[model samples]
Structures are given as C-alpha cells and as structure tokens.
Target: MNVLKPLSGSTLALLACMAAGALCGLVAEPAGALAYLFGQLYLAVVNMAAMPLLVVATFFGLRQVCELPRPAWRVGTIGALALGLMVLCGVAGTLAGALAMPGAHLPEHAYATFGERLLQSAGDAQEVGVTLFDGADAAVSQTSAYGWREAVPDNFYRVLAQGHPLGILAGTLLFGLAFAALSREQTSMLGNVFEGVYRTLEIIIERANLLIPVLAFGTAAWVSAHTPPAMLAAMGSFLVCFLACAAVLGGAATALTARRAGLPLVQIVASLKAPLLVGLTSGSATASIPHTIEAMSARLGFSRGIVELIVPFGAVFVRAGSALYFSLATVFVANLYDRPLGAGDFAVIAFASVGAAFLSSGKSGVATVGYMGVVLSLLQLPAEAASVLFVTIDLICEGPRNVVSLLAVCAVIALVSAGLPSERVMPEPLRAQPQVRAPLRFALSRGQLALVAGCAMTVASLIVLMGIGVGAK
Candidate 1:
C-alpha cells in the first residue's frame, strides 16, 4: 500500500504518457497536436495557482526567518551560498559549452536560413553584422544600468497581475516585516490567517499537480511532432553538453549534502524520489514544493521551521539550472555565428546569465525565452534567432533543468540544517514495526548510485558524440 502512493502513480503516468505521446507524434500529427493542447491546458491550470502559492508561502517563510536567532546573519549566509552556487553553475556551463563547441560545424546555408527567418519574424531590415573579440563596450552602452527603480514595482497590483515574481517577493517581504513589527496579539492573529492561506494554497497546488502527466504527454507530443529533425540535430551538441553538466553537478551536490548531514545516501535519495521525479517530469520546480517540504521534514528529519523558511524562498530565487542553460545557450549562439569571445565577454555572460537566472519563471518556457532576450541584449547580441532556436528545444531541456534546480535546493536545505543545533532538527517518527534492510549482492549506496549514474551519462554522451561524429550534418 505504501508503494501505491500518488508520486509513484504520477511517475508511472508521466513515463507512459511520454512514450505514448512520442509514438503518437511519430505516427499521427493530429493526435499529437491534440495531446499537446491538453498539456498546455494542464500548464495553464497549474500556473494559475503557482504565483498565489509562492506569495503565501514566502510571506510565512519570511516571517519565520525574522523570528530566527541572529536572523540577519542566517539570511545573509543562505543568500550568499545560493548566489555563489548560481555563479558556479554559470561558470561550469560556460566552460562545458566552450569545450563542446555546439555550433562550430553549422552549415553556412543553415545559419543563413535561420538568420533570415529570424529577421523576417522580427520584421527587421537591419543588416546582420559579425565581429570578433569585441569587448564590453557595446554591452555597456546598450545595457540598461540596474538601479533600485527596476527592483521596486511602480504598482503592486500591476506587478502581481503581470506575474512579476521578484516584485511580489519584495512586496511580501516588506509586508511580512510590517506584520512582524505588530503587537503580539495582532501578530498572532495575522500569522494564523497567513498560515491558513498558505495551507489552502498548498492543497490547491497539490490537486493541480495531479495534472502533470497530462502536461507531459502534450509537451512530448508537440515537441516530437513539430520540431524538425534538422533543428534537433543542430541542438544535439548543446543538449548533450547541458545534460552532462546537469547530471554531474546535481549528483555531486546531492552526495555532498547527504554526507554532510550524516544520513544514508540511499535513504535521502529514496525520500526525495517523488519530488525529484515530479520536478523533472513537470519541468516546474515550484510544483514540487509540497513534496520537497515533506521530504525535508517528515523523511529527512530537518526542522520544519527551517524547511519551510528555505524551500519557498529558494524555489523563487535560487535557479542554478537556469543560470547554467543561459550561459551555455549564449555560447552556443556565439559559436553558431563564429563570434570570437574574450575573457571580458565571458565575464559579461557570467554576470548576465546569473542575473537572469534569478528572474526565471517556473511555469513554462515562454518566460525563459523572454528572459534570454534580456541576457543577449545585454551582450549586444541579436536575440531573435537565438530565442526561437532555444525555445524549440526548451521542452526537452526543461526537465533536466528543473531537476538540477531541485537538487540545489536540497543541498541548501542540508547545509542550513547542518549549521543548526541538534535540538533544532526533528527526530524521525517511530514506525509501526521495525523496518528490515535487505542485503543486496552489490551494495551501492545512494551517493555511489548518483556517481555511477553521472559517470554513465558522461560516458554515454562521449560515445554518442563519437558515433555520430560531432561534425555530422
């Protein structure tokens, strides 16, 4: 009965739908289109609840943070670590892209065709120009200087309506602070109300999450039926490199966190399976919040207060996966155009990519594409074609990206828990009966499992590259 949980059902459904969608896409275009529409509808349903959930959860989370001992230092330490990890992701992605050289062998005609299509789509008459080793002069001149004005919303309602998450986050934090400053009686009443709201939204999101398999089916069908083989082939190098990086980084992060927490790697992985699978298949880390909180507190024995405080905040702000993809995609586009990059250009890319990653939305690929434009524009690069190209394969890449993001959050949870006193951490509940550990012929722990999986993926990627010949047209 325990094995028959919602997460297991969802995972099985997702895998089945993906396979069915792929088959339908290959065999019948109309059927695939229908499935794709269903997926879009599911995405819309879940997205409807996403922002509200974030608002309520974050409000309560920040309120709790304010109650922590030395709250300022705790917040600062977590923020710094999150930001540092994002920067590392960006740097790693850039290095991988450079080594893979995704578009180095792109056919001239194909490049011209893509560029022409992009220009046509944008209705732009400007001649496409190419230059080598251009410094940050163009980027500096073209980029909008960041200021407090951009961070602060002009109208709270407009920001919320427009789904500007960062603005909402800012507004919520301020509101939480004000609530905290109230008299104890007033604060208690408001806290109860906020908790009620958070729980209600959490319930709504959980129900909405049951629709993920339908979403996966449609996305897989649409992507398979509509994306041309040539475009997919063109994206092969980038995809391989991106997935490889994700696997390695995610695995390493998970292992380190597990070891630091003094938990059996297998137990941690087992507990996290549901949220991880949901995140990967749904391509939305926010959708997995309920499961993440459960895994952290109920399963891994983290303090509920800390888990609640960190996960919501991390879901919105700590997007290591998005940062990685942005850096990699920028490099891919540069390679496609034979653009020579310098140390300064990479620095700008790192800065822009990390900045944009913080602003990534958890709903769908559309917001991601829009954000990529800002990053490209900051580098004074033409974004029209690159945006279209990336969006074409965004569905395929999104799952792994979400997985990486979730893993980062888990790592943060472990680190934060480690710093807390033992009394702050919760003890595991007593089971109805003593659970037996089954001995295996080859006993590989969860951390070792992660390492093995990562190494396997790396080897597979290399073999595929060699077999296909990276220069293949």
Candidate 2:
C-alpha cells in the first residue's frame, strides 16, 4: 500500500465533491448554494490551518538548520535562486496577463464583480483602470487587473484592510521565547511541559490532517455552485498557465541540476512525476514525502540511505515552490495595499523568503513558525493578507515546488552517494553510519511541530475572523 494512500484518497474525494457541486448547480439552484457555503467553509478551515502551520514549522525548521554545519550556503543558494525566479515569474506573469487580457473593457466589470471576491482570495484589490483595445476583430474598451486576485474571495479584502493574524503571530513568538526562557536546566517541569506541548501539537496536527480532504471537497463544491460558467472557463485558462509556468521552471531546474550532477534529468523527472502531481493537486509536500522517497530510490536508483537523508532534509530546507510563492505573494500583497515595495523592502523580502524556505518542512503540520513570524516582523505587510492570499492556491504552487525539491535532493543524493560504497544502500546500516541518517533526521524532527501548530493556529483564527467578519454585521 502507498504510504500516502490516505492523501490520495482525500484528494480524490475533493475532486469528486467539486464535480458534484458543478453538476448540481446545473440540476438545481438552491442545492448549489448550500453546497457552495459548505464547500467554502471547508476551504476556510483548511486555509485556517495553513498560516499557523507555516509559521510554527518555519521557526522550528530554521532553528534546526541553524544547528547544522555548512547548511547556510546550501540552503541559502537554492533559496535565493528560487526567490529570484518567483519574483520574476510574478512580475512577468502579471504583466503578461495584463498585456494579453482578452477583454479591453472588462476591467471595470471584473473589478465591480470580482473586487470583493478577489480581495478575499488574494488579500488585496486589483488596480483596475480603463484602457483602449484595438483588436483584429474590432476596437474594444476594457478594464484589467494585474493578477490572480480577480477570481478569489472577500476574506482577502479583510486581510488587507485589517492587519490581522499578525497580532496572534506576535503573541506566539513571545510564547516560544518564554517557553525557552522558562525551561532552563533548573526548571525540569517547565521543560517537560514545553516538550509535551510540542508533542501534543504534532499529534493533533497529524490527526486533524485527515479532515483536509472532506473540507476540500466541500469547498470545491461551493466554488462550482456560485461561479458562473464563464468565470470557470476563465479560471481554467489561468490554471493552465499557472501549471505551465510551474512545469517550465521545474523542468529547467531539473535539467540544469541533473547536468551538474551528471544524472539523467528525464529519469529524475519521470521518477518524481506522480509524487509531484500528487503534491501539486493536494498542495501538501509533507504528504508527498513517502512517494517522493519511493520514486527516488526505486525508480531513480538512489540508495535508501541517501533517499531518506536527502529527501527529508530537502523538505525542511529546500522549499523551492514555497520560496517562489512567498516572493510573489509578498510583492502581490504589497501591490494590493498600494504600497509598492522598494529596493530595501525587496532586499528584506529576499532574505525573508530564503529564511522561510529554510524554515519550511515537508511535514504537513505546523511548519510555518519562522515563516509567519519573519514576514510579519520584518515587513510592514498585513498578516491577514498572507492568510488569504495563498490558502486556496497552495496546490497551484506546490506542484512546481516539489519538482524543484525533488531535483535538488536528487542532486544532493547523487553527489553524496557517488562517493559512498552503495548506490542502493540499506536503510538500517545507513542509519548506523554517522554520515547518513542520525544528524539529518535529528535536525528535521527537533521541536518542529509545536512551533508550527502554535503559529498556524494563530494565523488561521485571524483568517477565519476576517472571512466571517468580527463584531457587527
């Protein structure tokens, strides 16, 4: 049985639910509305979990990286490259979308119709403006927004409008420091309690993860119900473009990396395709680890020892996709707020994206710790904006991210294992070797969950409040 079978099952169910919601809308109206609300709420919860998870995971993951030798350069180089690519993609993609926009006069209509929705989805508003269009068929009047927010929800608006989750995220940082401070060698009980808190958070995140699919289904169904055929059609093109961009970036990186490693890029990509697909569709790299490992070793000829060490290690530090997304997202959010980032801000963003990627892990739970904290503290960004901007589109980003990660890890494994005795080393004896498992695993597993959960919960709560609205109606 596939270790990620559970993840696959959930994803399938989500697809089914979306299909059902779409068709049900054609069959009737009211049922579609109900489906829409429930589906949306399901997504809401998932989104709820994402930010805090990112925050906590980031903190612990970074701390873990800090404990390693010579990781700064390895993690930093890949991260910087990933960040640069993402920023380029974001700017280029937005410009391309604007230049090639189908309807010249459609901007106002889009904004009037999708402004609230886009805000909810992307956490900011589009700078819609009038433009003249001279097409082959006819001259047309048009309005256009620069990015993907035109299709999302209202929660995004709330996030931008109010600086949220930042407060809660701030609180979590204080708590983490406090926990460490209170847990000096003398305070055994405090230390034990902190340890238990971390463990419990991991357990809860792991178990609660099972609910993601059910929620995903409901959300898809809801999206199908409310969105018109035309909107869905437009979204289809966007998804295609997004996937294409992700593939090109991933493919290029794999080829270049493989060339450097003297491995077959095709073999490496083919080995990772299913896992990459699963990861993209599910938007969870953590869930894709088992399959990634299997593909690396069984199909790609990596030793078990190498696969285990590099894959997991890569998951925490080499979040190529997340790094890309964060870079794009930071800029996109800034644009929405009408606070275009300057060189200094961009520099800070570059560093933060690298840090966030280092802090990110392949585990699904509580991985956002350092990430959430860093963004909120370093940037003048609204925390609620972060919560809304990427939640629904995570899978859209994860696909390429995982592929990049797969390639990066493959390179590392190839380099490391080429020097070793076995190209197919057993896991047991490999773990016994100091060169393979212990230090790596120890780095990944240390206090990762507690930080992830605490930060994620805090972010989620803020997002929920933004969507549901706080105080009065």
Give me the candidate number with maximum lDDT: 1
lDDT of 1 by residue, 305-362 (tens): 6677678777778889899999988988888877888888888788788877865643
lDDT of 2 by residue, 1-473 (tens): 24433643454655665566556666665766664455345334444443444344433433333334454563455345444544444444444333333223333443343345544454434553222122311210110110112222235435323423333333443444344344246556654654455444444434444544443444445445555554444234344544555576666666754664355777656566655644544445444455666666666555554454445445544555555445545554455445655667766665566545544443332234224434434555554434433444443344456565555555555554443343443433235557645454434444787888888999999998987775546
lDDT of each: 0.74, 0.48
Using all chains and alpha carbons, the TM-scores for the candidates as numbered come to 0.80, 0.46
Q: For candidate 1, which ten residues in a row score worst on lDDT? A: 141-150
RMSD of each: 20.9, 24.5
Candidate 1 lands at a TM-score of 0.80
Worst 10 residues of 2 by lDDT: 139-148
